[model samples]
Target: MTAFVLVSGPFTGGEVWREVAARLEESGAEVYPATLTGLGERREAGGPDTGLETHIEDVVRLIDGVEGTELVIVGHDYGIHPVLGAADRRPERIARIVYLDAGLPQDGDAAVQLVPDEEVRRRLLDPADRDGGTGWIDPPAADGWQRWGSTAGLSEEALARLTGLASPQPSATFTQPLRLSGALATVPTSGIFCTESGMSIAKLEGLMTLGMPQFKALADPRVSFFDLDTGHWPMLSRPDELAELLLGAAAGEGHRLAAAPAQELPGYLRPFVLDVPEQTRERIGRVDLYLPADPDGAGAAGANPADAAGANPVDAAGANLAGAAGAAGAADTAAAPRPAVLFVHGGPVPETVRPTPRDWTTYVGYGRYAASQGVIGATLDHRLHSLADYPLAAADVAEAVELLRADPRVDGDRIALWFFSGGGPLSADWLSAPPSWLRCLAVTYPILAPLPGWQGVDSRFRPVDALAGAGRLPVVLTRVGLEVTEIAATVEEFVAAAEARGTDLQVIDVPHGHHGFDTVDPTDESRAAVEQAVRSVLGHL
Candidate 1:
């Protein structure tokens, strides 16, 4: 029997391939399904912060465990990037390639950008897609999965596992184009486009024509193409037929697959922002700031991508504030002078041009619940340690603080702050030395790496010397069940570390079955507990 390796796309796990695998198995072919870093239970230490190389390693590792020269890579959705890298690295092992209704990656674009149906593709993208240096689209819900993915055959377990997959894909893949040294040409590549009835016919047509012209252009020698009158998910829609097509291609039963039908072009401009360099007065230093206008903003709001009824962030907020304000192109509400919560978003150098209504845990769906809390949420784009000469991300935070204080609505005196992941530590450093008036802090999953090795600075959780002046602030340490299994040993570990340092710390292990407890829509119990945590901190503030 021939051995095949099927790789599932984003928001899915190896189990998603079961139906297809079972079908192939019934037909006498052995199948090994591969899941990427953050897809299924596979969501590991590496996320967007981990790049294309990580994904390549993941596939290679899976390949090493399986013994077969008859290896065929069948990549679906986001899985295509790593599969190419795998084939690029291990051409000898691959017998043939099958792209199951997936986009062909380019040297300079990520999965999201690779698709040509700009308007239709953007229709699914959301404001939660923050720029984490890797150009990642925040992982959306099942609804999002359906937007670009064919989900006909996804199992209950496969769909259930998605809720646990946390962290927006680290953005690097989207920003950094793959550097294919022409390795893809060596493999006999095939694109399988599933033709669905209710599917976006016009959109699929655009994907073939404008979205993937290279596939069409490569009409001759190396690459092969085919179309199926099936749903988005062939494995579920027509698994046996799809399996036969793959096996037949492997056995050379048909000629090179023909290109699917093409349709008219669709208009689009992904809402992305660029980080142009900005220099300080007196030529102090040059820093990059992505003015959060548009990923490619057209000066004004043209149309709301999310439906006015379903999953629209504007409507989700119960008021289309961003929509209305954007529609009128109203000036940004002048920032307040005080009562501010300095928010330093993830990524060392941030391009969080998009905003999420909910916190890290999307337990309750994406809601702007943070802004509604009567706090002046200050989200800033900070340059990373690499970009800054002195490695002072705090400087950028401080400057942003000043900018916020400069606003009439902000109260600089009674400042309360919140930081998630490494942003907490960076927030602490800025609060310790600066002239800004910061009173309380709530840091979630603070990164403690820099403090230990930072020469000339006392980062060993030192007290009394500078930042806090021997005064302790209420600290909340949170950890999800998964983080303990993966990295930290529950939220108590952080609390214990803080206690040993003589710093007061309150720990909450947010009794959620999954990780990323802070994102919105945490399961009912976990979600309520997180809200309680936030409320307790608010009381302290």
Candidate 2:
């Protein structure tokens, strides 16, 4: 069984989590609801001397008092401070940190710094300073309380109990900067976002736009985000749903995702077949759309689901189409169309091994990863080597693009095209005159021009020849510095040409990595590099 330690925010006591904790306990979790010193029943002990360190000590003591190894630390609002601090101190014992409508802070960032809006800060802090100096901060006015409690959907008596039980917070807690030792980053984390929190989401987005530290902390690859429709207090509004999300996270489901369902995300393989008259194969080619979990409609915020397919895209063959197509089709209909990524795999293999849905296993995982990160992901099956050269393959890409653009669940104008390995040559036409439907181009360890294996091919296969006309489309390239591939010289040529043309080309070099590091090496470095590349591509979308 899992042991959950729930920490409440400023002014609120552990009793506020009574409903949520009760539900967790019913589900067989050993729950410990913690009240920080001076903010709950211990209000008399709080003063100017009670800083963030004191609050952290309070939680560390509770964690030490716990009985089990599967410790999950949960923080709500201001409780994030102590919870994160304690988790940093005991990463060995902690299983994960569940941020429940909480503020995430970086090392050396004070609570005040985490608050992105000046008006709101002034509204909360100015009055506190004027009333009681730095020792304690008083609660907000009546209307302020109403607004904060509005989405909680509490009964009159429950609301009264909440308002009446609120206590003054120690001012030092807000001013004290968090001091971390890189320990917090190692722990698995999940965020249960209250969509009704009018301020936090906007603040986070603003930080991300500015490329700040707090934004990076919240957007770490290890963190999973789940949106709840209720306001700041799900304990009072949607306790059962909150409990289920916590339990699901504790069970290691939806562990590292941008957005996931409160309940289990369904396992479905969906294919979006492209109906273009390229006139080649007997069967119509398809780009499998790897979507995230269907919204449970139990206050689930976003429509992001992950997909399933196996093997490297080049090695995917002999897949059973009949067995994979029809399960849970009804469950996938309501997913709102999102920003998508169109994956173009490399390889100029024999015409007999032309692209197929099953052949895109490796790339499909990338698409699935995109869906997990709140974007729609689709992997295409284009013509192979001798089957059709660059120009024809480019046409196949265009047809697939049209298919994606016509789909209701896709943000057509914001789509990205990712070219892997040998598929890079087919991107020349897109780079020369990028369309409005294209957001950016991501090329990884690519064959930018006709190499030894592809010498004397059609003129269209030479991507380097068209770099001067790459327009202004942003291109993120992942370079493998270790392997000496035949395309190395051509890739360098492409880089120089693209730079001279002022193309927005950003190259990330994996110094000790080989070609296809993501699929071949699959080490921690490989995973990190893949995540970085994935993040870069999604940023354009």
Candidate 3:
């Protein structure tokens, strides 16, 4: 059975979580609201002697007494310190930690040290702990509820509820440093950002963009992020929303929000959205660029490849006909242009410009993988639905190719195009008349030939017919064995034509794999095969 342990912030008690607890209990969950020593009912029992360690011990005892196998530990405000300490001590007992408007503490980091605002520390924290003082920190003034983020829309009821139950915090909880055995990192963590407070997704992303070390953990992809439009005390102002978010976190769907994966990009990778000019302003095709940072982590190198005038277009054009090894050797330079791969995603719709979460994750994952292997990964969206027919779809690919070739970080002479599923037939022109700079063409379970229903469109959509003009452009084709016979026949026809025309093509058959194996199965075998496929393309590049 799964149990939840909710810990309240400084100068607050577990009573603050009364409403949220009630909702979770209604869901048949075993919930425990922990009141640390020197706070809530225990205020009179604690004095100067009550330190951070005592608070940690308080939660540790509660966890030990709980009658459950898995635990979802929740911490709010200053309560995060003791909760993290307890989690480090008992990692296996924890299923996940849902932090509510709280700053995370590292192994040797103190609670006070985690606060980014110096004014808050100097005004509230310092005065309370000075010269071995009463070891108690006073609560914020009632008039400053907005600054404290305790009230959502400045409701008198919410403010009265907050100040009514507020108590003095133990000074030791702020001064004492937390110690971790590195077990905390292994545990799955989540966060609920009170957007009405000072912590917005944009602010967090800004910190990540600046590469600030203090905010590193918040940038982790594994830690799901959520936003509540209320103040810091959502339980008091918006209990239903808070309860639903907590329940979602428990169900492991907290990462469903759009802001969840915004910070998933690594520090070494610079991501930007490129708008395709030919499309409508509202529905223009967009391409995402993930350029790898240089070795020294300064920024992206080879971003100004267009500035290098040494590249000869004629030489690259001639290299297309020269066989794989010859073409690869011809483009070699002392300061070679960075290799780039254009990613085209597949979907049921003919033209898909904005990919879904599954598609985005898969593309970004492949992009990062390509960057790790010393190549640029670019994901492009094409006009879908009404304007997604044969010739128009092919035009979208051409525009994306032109954009990649024009990028400063890309070697205009060393580019590869990867098509997935429905996108296979649209790139027939590239396969038919292979370009000198087009190093490799890779497709995974693609619709190589037009289907019977789509024959009303132009004949140029037929990829197998274009194989005669493919010349010697190196190709990597991944076929899923479990695919339907129609698609299988298309793959077979493309392969046979490529062989007959003497086009340099490599075929990889995943007999036990289904379509979108990487996204669906994600097994070790699938991962290894994808890596091998990428390596094969890179080898030809």
After superposition, which runs of candidate 2 have C-alpha atoms over 4 Å from their true positions? 114-120, 123-131, 146-152, 198-221, 255-541
Span of 10 residues, lowest total lDDT, candidate 3: 275-284
Candidates ranked by lDDT, best first?
A: 3, 2, 1
Candidate 2 structure quality by residue, lDDT tens digits, 1-541: 7999999876788898888889999988899998888877888878778889999999999999987576989998778988888888989989989888775565765665333233434443465443345476666543456433334555667667677878887777877778888887679888876766643343344323222122344555667767677777778778889888889878765534233232531111222111111111112134466654445634211322221332213223423322232231233446566787888876554344423433443565676577667676667666654412455567778777766666555666899998877688888888777787788899988878765312224555567777666677889999877544455677898889887778898888887776666655546676778888888988987
TM agreement with the true structure for every prediction: 0.41, 0.45, 0.47
Model 1 — which ten-residue stretch has the worst lDDT?
279-288
Candidate 2 Cα RMSD (Å): 23.0
Q: Across residues 141-227, which tens digit of lDDT does each residue of candidate 1 receive? A: 656555444455556655455544434554554434556677666677666767552323333342233222233445444565566
lDDT of each: 0.49, 0.66, 0.68
Which of the predicted structures, 1 or 2, would earn the higher TM-score when compared with the native? 2
On the 0 to 100 scale, the lDDT of residue 352 in model 3 is 23
Q: Which candidate gets the maximum TM-score versus the true structure?
A: 3
Instruction: Give candidate 3's whole-model lDDT.
Output: 0.68
lDDT, model 3, position 475: 90
Give the TM-score comparing model 2 with the true structure, all chains together: 0.45
